[model samples]
Target: MPEILIAALSPVGHFGPLLNVARGLVDRGERVTVLSGAAHEREIRSVGATPATLPPQGDLDLDLLEPDSGREEISGIKRLNFDIVRLFVAPMPHQAKALAELLTQKRFDAILADYGFFGVLPFVLGERSARPPVLLFSTTPLMISSRDTAPAGLGLPPSTSTFGRLRNRALTLLSQKVLLRPAHKAANCQLHRFNSPELPTFLLDVGVLADRLIVPTVPEFDYPRSDLPANTRYVGMVHPSPTMRFRPPVWWQKLDGDRPVVHVTQGTVDNSDPRRLLQPTIEALADENVMVVATTGGPHVSELGFPIPHNAYVADYLPHDLLLPKVDVMVTNGGYGGVQRALSTGVPLVVAGNTEDKPEVAARVAWSGAGIDLRTGDPTAKAIRAAVREVLGDGRYLRRARELEAAYAQRDGVAEIAALIDEVIGERAVAP
Candidate 1:
C-alpha cells in the first residue's frame, strides 16, 4: 500500500470530509499522515491516520477570531476580505514551512490538501517534478471563477444569456482586480519568499492547476462551468463521517411523535452567536405546527443565553446521520457539507446564511429547487417562519430533494477519491 499525506485546516467543515477520505484510505491498508491543528489530534488518530500538528502560526483557534462579548461580528464583503487575509493568506508561510519540513523527513506517494490549506500551494506552484502529486479537494462551494456565474462571494446565480455572461465577466474582473487584489498580492509575497512562481490567475482558481481537483458533490448540485478544467472531478459527497458516534438525546424520541420535525443549525465554526440564525429560527417556529430541533453547533445549551421556547428542543450537538433522516426540513447557515448531507437524505432546506461561502451555498439550494434562500446573515423571525412554511407546504421542494437523493445513492465518494489518488500516484511513478 502507498503512503499518503493529508494536509487539512482545523475547522470541522473542512477537516471532517477529508477525515472521511483518510479513513477510507486507511481501511484499504494505506499509511496516512494528517497534518492539522492540535485540536483534531484525537479524531485524526481515531480515523487511523497519524496526526501531525501545524506549527504555532498555522495551528489557529477559529473561535478566538470572533468579536468580544457584546461586540457585533463583521459580515458581507468586509468579513470576506478579513477571512481571505487573516485566515487564508496570513498562514501561508507557516503552512508551507510545515509541509516542507515533513517532506524533508519522508517521501510520501502523494499529498491531499483541503481547499483552504494554502500551505500546499508552494508545492503546487513549484516545478511539478520537485514534489509528489498534490490532490486538492473542496468542502465548500466551488469557487473557481467562471463565465457562467458571478464571483463566488456575491451569491449570483448562473446565467447563460449574452448579457448575463457579460455581467459575470465584468464582476469577475472587478473582484479579481479591485476587491481581491490585496489577497492576490499577499499570496504572491509568500510565494516570492518560497521562490515559487506567483499564481497565474486568481487565488481560488489555483485549484484547477492541481493534479486532480476533487469536488465532494455531484455535478447537479454545483453550477456548471463550461470552462471547467479537465482535472476537476465531481466525486459524490464523501459522507457519513463513520467516526461520529451518536447517542440519542433524552428528547430524541419526540421526532417519532405527530408533529413534523424541522432542524436548525448555525453549523460548527460560526455558531458563536446564536442570534445570527439559531435564535431567530427558534422564535420563528415557536407557534408553528412543526417541532423545531435547534443545535448550538458546539456551545452549551445554556450558552444560547436565552429561554428555549415550548415548541423548540435544544442540543449542543447531534449527529446528522441519525437526526437528518427524521427531519422534514432543515434551516441552516448553508454550510456546504451540511447542505449536501440534507439533500442526500431528501430533506429540503431554508438557508439564511450570507457569510463565507454560505450565500453561494444558499443560491445553489434555491437554484436546485431544493430550498428557499432568505438572503441575509441575520434573518428576521418573520423571514424564517415564512421560508420554513414555504418549504414545508411546497411539494416541489421535496420532489427535487428526492431526485438529488437518488443521484447521491448512485456513487461512493470515498471509493472514487481513493481510486483517483492511486491513478495519480501510478502516473507519477511512470513519468520520465
Candidate 2:
C-alpha cells in the first residue's frame, strides 16, 4: 500500500471532492493524509483519514471560501486579478515552504494536488530529484487555454472560424497582461525562494507543467478541444462531498407538485448575502406558478430576514444529490460543483456570476445550450425571471442538459482515478 499525501486548495469546492477522493484512496488500501486549511481538518477526519494543515495566510485561509464581507466593492477584471494575487499568489511562499517541509518529513509514495494548489510548484518543478510523482485533478472545468479553446477568465464561447480564432488569441494575450500579470510577478517573487525562474504566464502554462491533468466533466459537456495532451484525461463528475450530510426540508413534497420547481443558490462562498442569487430568484419566481427552494450555504433559514413567499422553502445546506433530480431549473452563481451537479441531473440552469472562474463556467453553460447566462455578478429579479422563462420555454436547453445527464450516468470517475494512481505508482516502482 502506498502512503499518499493529497494537497487541496482550502475551499469547500476544492476540499469537498478531494476529501471524498481521499476516502477512496483509503478504501483502496492506501494510507492517506489530506493537507489543506485548518477549517477542513474535521472534514478530512470524518472520511477516516489523517489531516495536515496548510500554512495559514492569516487567522484563516483567504480563498474564495471566505465570506464576502465586502465583495461587492470589488469589480472589473483588474479587481479579479488583484483578488487572486491577494488570496493565492501572495501566500505562495509560505505554502510552498510548509509543503516542502511536510514532503521531506513524510515518506509518501505519491502526491495528489488540486489544480488550485499552486504552492506545489516548488516541490514538483524546482531542482529537486527526490520528489514523488504528481497527479493533478480539477473539481471545476479546466481553466487552461488551448489552441482549440479561448483563454480562461474572458467568458468567451468557442470558435472555429479564422476571425474567432484570432479573437481568442487576442483575449488570451489581453487576459495574461490585464488579469494575470500582477499575480505572475508576485508568484515569481515567491518562486525565487525556491530558486525557480519566473513564468511568462499562468493559465495555459500550468497545463504544460503537469503531465497528467484530470478534468471532472465529460468531453461533450465541455467546449471541444482537439489538442488535449494524451495525459490530459477526462474523468466523470466529482460528486459533492459525501461526508456532508443533508436533511430534506419538511415541504420536500412540493417538488412533486404541479408547479415547476427551481433551486436557487449562491453556492458556499459567495452565499454570504442571499440576495445575490437566492433572494432575487425567489422574488422573481414567487408570484409566478413555481416553487422556489433556496439554500443559505450554512446560515439559518431565518437569517434571510425577508417576507417568505408562501410557495418558497429555505435551508442551510441541502444535498445536491437529493435536490437536483427533482429540480426543474437551477438558478445559481455558477460554482463549479453546483453547476455540474445540476447539469448531471438533467436540470438546465440560469447562471449569473462574474468573479474568479464563474464567468468561464457561465460561458460554457451558455455555449452548451444547457442554460442562459445573465453575465453579471449581481443579477436583477427581472433578469433572473426573464432568463428562467427563456430556458423553461425553450425545450432545447433541457434537451441538451439531458444529454449531459446520460453521459454523467455512464460513470462516477472514482474507479478511473484509482486506476490512474495505480499505474503511476506501478510505473514508478519499476523505473531504474
lDDT score for candidate 2 against the true structure: 0.80
Give Cα distance to truth, residue 59, candidate 1, Å. 3.4
Question: Tens-digit lDDT track for model 1 on 1-432?
Answer: 798999998878888888899999999999999999888899999989999889768754464466662124765455666768788888889999999999999889999998888989989988899999999998787899888999988888999899999999999999999888878888898889988899997897988889999988988898998999889998899986643566788888989998999999998877888999998889888889989999888899987787788889998888888889999999999998889989999999999887778999999999999999888889999999998898888999999999999999898999999999999999999999
Find the candidate with the highest TM-score and give its number: 1
Instruction: Please give, for residues 75-148, the per-residue lDDT of candidate 2 as tens digits.
Output: 67657666766766766777777777888888877788887777777766754346777888876678777666
lDDT of each: 0.89, 0.80
Off by over 4 Å in 1: 60-64, 68-78, 242-245
Local error of candidate 2 at residue 106 (angstroms): 2.4
How does model 2 score by TM-score? 0.92
Report the number of the highest-lDDT candidate. 1
